[model samples]
Target chain A: MTTETLTPEDERRFLDEILRRELTPSRSIAALLAGVLVVLLCVYFLLETILALFRLPGWLIDPDEALNWVAGLPGTGPGPVLALGGAVLAMVGFFFLVSALMPGRRARHSLPHPVLAVVVDDEVVASALARRARLAANVSPAQVMVTVARAQVLVNVRPTSGLRVTDDAVERAVTEELDAMGLSPRPSVTVHLASTGVVGA
Target chain B: MNGTPRGLNRFITGLLGLLLLLLGLGILLVSLVPPVAQAWRDFAAPLVRGLHGAYEATPLPAGSSWLYVVVAVVLLSVILLTIRWIAGQGQGRASLLVERPDHSATDGEVTISGNVAEQLLRAALSGRGDLLGLHVVTYQYRGITALRVRLFPRKGASPQKLVQDVESLLEGLDLMVGHHTPVLVHLGAGTRAMFTREERVR
Candidate 1:
């Protein structure tokens, strides 16, 4: 009988590897939105065409009228109408092209590790870091704001009155904590201390 | 983490984008050039006239009420299917089966339910002072079962320490289950804490 035991190092390595695969942005939301829009438009046009075929009362759209509108474009000899239509088309095309190319949203980050894979969500990272900053600054949790980005972690500290919170101290604390996590492609840490301190317990 | 969009979705979006870009450019060019516009109009005139003529001449036959019904049913079916496809676009597999390394012909495979995994995680991690809330969900990743652990941390909790504790808990879970499963830890801010604190201070 063979049994498998994963040491802490093995677990760490596994997490590191998985993180890389799981952290990248997904295009699912964009795809779903686009798919629904296209389907609705197709259904609308198909319904209209079918209604026109049946000579229904609600079939206000005339194929002849649409065709005539297109046919009449040349008679007007390149006016604002054609330009506006072209511009609208161009805008729509640009939107689609950008959506196709743009990375939708950064929801998670893959930690750097050679053997193990691990992915952590940005929100989780932010929350965790916020707690760390709050403790280090000796400020209320609400006074600390943490933003976790792909390449950077921004910590904004609003110190309470009578508490002297230095940027270097907060920065060092955050840096050490982040370093201990052993994040791959480690993001740089930025600590900002607001000048005005909030009055709170 | 959510998986990437399906291949078909990306392809369709790319195709639509390319088509729209080309159509827009062509329209812009035609609008700018009088000669090109004239050519386009001349080319489109007969097609437009033919389409209108066809529409006028092809009214449904007087006694073909059944034909309308058939067409309506087919169209409705197509619409329904399209809607269903759209709704299911990004859904991922919910459960994963634990693979058996050595099995006789009669041995059966073990199935891991996502909800069960969530319950196990909650049972293991709940009541920790550092954690405000815990949610566990399972998703298929790269053809294998993976768990996503979303944690809302208590204010002033050390992020590094919280992560270490979570890792240890997961290790214990893996040992108990007899198979190692990938786990994703998501740390999120405690919304309730943030809002309540703000209201109190105000």
Candidate 2:
């Protein structure tokens, strides 16, 4: 309708922003952990300082004593404790660094549409592929398994004892289904038929 | 689609990581090397002494130290700020979907609540067993109101069919509203979809 007034550039920008946010994983976990940690640290110091103002002993030690202990850590603290604490801190830092650097993409793919923007999760795609493959091979749902990866789809089928199922039929059906979906960066399809068929129907 | 400050989150995480990395490595180094330990002692001794001096000199009413009051206030503010930041995540859901001001009209304004779109779409898309659940949420993106329709597809449900069905429904909404509203259709397989057994009519 009135969306026709959107220029190509505007549409592209709109889709780009939406897709960028939709595909990337949110950093809520990291933020929450960091925020909680900071809050805890601040609370500890606040309590310690308040206690020291009235000349009361801190839960662990006096505020001044705690500082002296920390200041003395690099020089006189036990070697093993320093090493362990340092290693743990370094590992935590590396974890945060990795989380920030990685794109953290979710399992999703976008489909081309004339007017509407659509994205489907890879799990959903796998389920659809499994259905198609099972129907094409004339097998029960339990006999077929589908795994959808970032760039490939694998369909495994176990034919019934008396019936014969060809890989070509399953592959063709899966490919046609994928074509109909028109997912961007279309994943390649692989069909595998088990040599040993199940006994009975 | 919701307003989450992802970039800032990443930045804060990275900064925390760098700080921790340096602190860890510094401790590890100081503990393992005599020269580093000696250097740290030399640097810290003066700072420790200076802090002690400050604590003794600064006295407020009731024998409480001004230095302690200042430190406590600073830590309290830091805790407050962090709590505020943690509470601000995942906000920005718009209740008003559309609002237009027309000076020439008697009413001079046209408004549509977000509930209208959500109800209309939900009513139109209901009774589809292929979808385990559906949610319509409105968000403000770049000063324009946009809609995100999240569909939980049952196992073995065709996403292609789902996309086409939603597109036609959106077209219906556009005709009713007399203006185009941008929409993002997301079809996902949640736990409900995973646990749903396929129903077959024999």
Candidate No. with top lDDT? 2
Q: Candidate 2: which pairs clash?
A: none
Error (Å) of candidate 2 at residue B61 is: 4.8
Q: What is the per-residue lDDT of model 1 for residues B48-118, given as tens digits with 9 covering 90 to 100?
A: 87865655555557532333445556767767865665665545555542544557577665555567666
Put down candidate 1 lDDT per residue, A1-201, tens digits, no spaces: 122335668656556545644554345555666667667766775676566556563355654465687775645554768777887887777777677776554566655433324455566667657766777899876688998787899999989988899999889888887887766568899998999988865
RMSD of candidates 1 onward, in order: 6.0, 3.1
Candidate 1 vs. true structure, TM-score: 0.73
- Candidate 2 C-alpha lDDT tens digits along B80-175: 987887887887778776676656748657677778887987898788878788888887766667788999988888898888888888888878
Docking level of model 1: acceptable
Of all native A–B interface contacts, model 2 reproduces a fraction of 0.76
Per-candidate DockQ versus the true complex?
0.36, 0.58
Return the lDDT, model 1, position B14: 63
